[model samples]
Target: MIQLGTRWLVGDEPPSRLPQPVIDAIYEVEGELAEQGVDASEWSWTLTWLEGKPVVELDDETTVEYDPETDSAIVTAPEG
Candidate 1:
């Protein structure tokens, strides 16, 4: 897991403080990417909150939004 500030990530687990929701989001995104044939080693995760919503940014293109209410991640891909 990756830890940045208060966000704990599964792919890039850093030695920082993080919350439970952020951790769950990282794992969720990791699973989703793996199902798509993307390995965890091929990417990184950054967790943050946007307007009180947990957002996980994968690499520089993909953004996964975590909804604690539904316990799911909403992935947003970069546009070409």
Candidate 2:
């Protein structure tokens, strides 16, 4: 299980075998982060869920929620 903020994100399967839609979401988020100058080497990444939706959470409190139906990722930041 991975913890993000006050929520715990868990999965019952291996990451490598994640569904293609999920993989696509991960790639999309990674691309967005890269464009924003966030280096993959500089932060850790994990596949988890937020509000029942798959998301890629970054170490800096950045989250990219993936919507499989729309094949899109919604990026969010920590709220102060």
The most accurate candidate by lDDT is: 1
Write one digit per residue (lDDT tens) for candidate 1, span 1-80: 44232433446664334345555655666777779886557556666656666566767467767566776656677787
> Candidate 1, clashing residue pairs?
1-13, 2-9, 2-12, 2-13, 2-14, 3-14
Compute the lDDT for candidate 1.
0.60
Residue 49 error for model 2, in Å?
Answer: 6.7
Which whole-number lDDT from 0 to 100 does residue 9 have in model 2?
27
Distance from true location, Cα of 77 in model 2, Å = 4.9
Q: Give the TM-score of candidate 1.
A: 0.48
Candidate 2, 1-80: lDDT as tens digits: 54333222222222654456655555665667668876555456566655666666766677667676776656676787
Q: How accurate is candidate 2 locally (lDDT)?
A: 0.58
| Model 1 spans with C-alpha error above 4 angstroms | 1-16, 47-55, 64-80
